[model samples]
Target: MSQQSVIQIALIEDDEIVRLAISQRLQLAGYDVIECADGESALSLIPTGFPGIVISDVRLPDISGLALLPQLLANNPEMPVILMTGHGDINMAVNALRDGAFDFLEKPFDPDKLIETVGCAIEKRQLQLGANKREEYLQQAQGLDQILIGSSPGMVELRQQLVKIANIDTNVIIYGDTGCGKELVADCLHKVSTRSQGNFVALNCAAIPEALFESELFGHEAGAFTGAIKKRIGKLEYADKGTLFLDEIESMPLNMQIKMLRILQEKLIVRVGGNKSIAIDVRVIAAAKESLKDNQGFRQDLFYRLNVAQLYLPPLRERGEDILLLFEHYVNLANIHAKPLSGLDEKTLLAYGWPGNVRELINVATRFGLDASLTVADILVTKPLASIDSSASELSLAMQTQNFERKVIAEALRTHKGSIIEVMDILDLPRRTLNQKMQKYDLHRADYI
Candidate 1:
């Protein structure tokens, strides 16, 4: 790697001999090493953007390595922290791992093992930082005012794909679940294109009556029919030199599908009652909630014509942390000053499967903003107790027991601020057993502290 891209490692060990030895080893292995003699020094020296993994001894002179782990994580959760433990400190080392230590080394450990572990952690960190940078670049390219707001990998890919397709004047088919922002994607396509100055006409194929579909799409001449009192420009003509967004295109009447296919194929349309053909310079962007190929009612020829470009939008559940990100966005839009979500609130939000996708989340966020006394219960699909019951029922007995134990231990740790004695007393666990359980769940007392 170039010097600019070289990974930096923060080595924190109070023992001068061990610190120097490890630092030299890491440096020899092509890593830039920042050496600190104690936890307190490391805390000040290793800034949030340290850009590497931390290797520290558990028994630091000023503060225990366990104590410093949480502080480092709080600064940058993605920064890996490795712990070096001494003989008879296996439990502490294990506990460190549970508490979010990337990996642990039992001293008198092999130098090669340390180097190998550091290499793996560095690679992982680089990948994470690279992803973040890519997301940032895409966002900047798309502009802050862009409607698609997310940093998830899926969203990043979608934005890049949208930017590529936007410049091309071709029909696009968007496949997404209801409320997954299909219309927003279509609008973005129109805004970034050459036709941005022209009108962006949107019509829901499912919302229009079958009888009026012809007139609504292709327009009618004056006195062409019983109710045709005036010459009307239809959606297609209205979108001339711009873009037409057809939402729920799968619901269009079968007979009308032929006319749409003809207009797409010929780049011209005849009025509902008149024979004069008008050339259209409009780009069609169609969206469907389900796969058009699987829908028996949809014509195969029309599907192929409109699907010159396709974009598959992931649901809210699959978007990971974007759920909370979007929720905060909607809350801001609602003009509500809200505090950061509590742990329980965040957990509940992540657990629920948002069948209604982003639309449902928007509704909840709006309601949450409007209602001062709103709780997670007000927005979540299942009550807390019921959700727990449902989860427990899904797992095997052994897995359920372990899950409950983890929760209980975590709660105790949180309540007592990682005080081992207090947690042991509250949970009625022996010291050794408590340590074992903590390590198993990767629970760190320092986190609560």
Candidate 2:
């Protein structure tokens, strides 16, 4: 392979003479070069995954090289960065290496030495990139990492615990906030379990009313009740020799909990209004937003039966950089006509507290994927993306006026970034009137901000 075609180098230095010198050396050494005069220029010039290494001076006209290193690495951590330090800055240079710099060059170093260092960094970069591609390909090919996708420490630990627990045949109770993938974890457990060939049944305990819980869970015999027309198999029976996932277990009424405990203890179930008892050999996985130990109404005995093993799914807020990774994952999965997410979009997503967790993220990703014009801010905002004017003719004049006022105020708030003074100035309204209108429409400045 020709080094000039495969390897690229970015030289960032404020001194034109030094930058030109290094750029020419790398070019003469049969490598491509991107030359920038300062830190800020370097940041914007070096696009994400810049297929090369960086050689920057320790002292820049604007941001310190040390500070800029983190921002650069945030986009591509494996991209090697080298610092050119003055004689007195040797200590700082050593610390940079400890903090992730690939190598450091002292001022007035031999021209040959620069080439030698660049060669070593390029070799390491190639290896790192190759490893990343291999792992990504493997993950695409049905690896465990493919199903549970997140690189945060919390996710890594969750996957480790899940793998260990999947081998065991005991029941598991998953604890997590709503939409944080409790059901996904349960599915993962089922897919890797010894009984993968059998049916995997799922029932939401909360969705079924208290009166219907019995019929939904234990099933009913023909003429079991006024509505029972025929005999049917319950989740436990259908999941025999397989896995049964019960979501929102906390919503189960006390009466049903008692019946569930009995079925669990006996390892069998009897259909409602039926005399025959059917034996069931199955593993049960229960999911709840609240901890069973602290739930005053849940039966401790039943908790023990189901809590033989447990997994805690961390909320997206706590996953750090994993937020961006998941957003990109969903965006790619959608495969629609949408612009690629920018760095500012990543910041906007990371700043907000995701109350709806993964489900909300998936929605935002899908919406953005489908619509080319919507920004991340637009998706995060409470207002509808596109309003319909077809109903304006049917509405009374007063109603239309009110809607128009709300839209004007909302647009001002968004444009001014929730600045009350600016909004009031633009709308020509007194403070009290503006406040009343905001209250009437249930719009808060914090939402726009």
TM-score for each prediction? 0.61, 0.60
What C-alpha lDDT, on a 0 to 100 scale, does residue 218 get in candidate 1? Answer: 91
- lDDT accuracy of residue 363 in candidate 1: 80
After superposition, candidate 1 runs with Cα above 4 Å error: 1-40, 48-145, 381-449
Q: Per-residue CA lDDT of candidate 2, range 175-252, in tens?
A: 999889988899988988898988899999989888888877778899988978889888888999999999999999
Give the whole-model CA lDDT for all candidates, comma-separated.
0.79, 0.79
Query: What are the C-alpha RMSDs, in order, of all predicted structures?
Result: 8.5, 15.8
Candidate 1 lDDT over residue span 1-449, tens digit each = 55324678888988888888888888788788899998888889878776777998888878988899999999889898888878536677668878888887888889987876776677667655654554454446447234788878998889889889998889999999887999999998899899999999999999999999999999999999998999999999999999999999999999999889989989899888899999999999999989898579999999999989999899888988777777766776785476434334444566667766888788878877776445443455333444333542233444445545666787788788889999889888897568545544445577789
Q: Write out the backbone clash pairs for model 2.
A: none
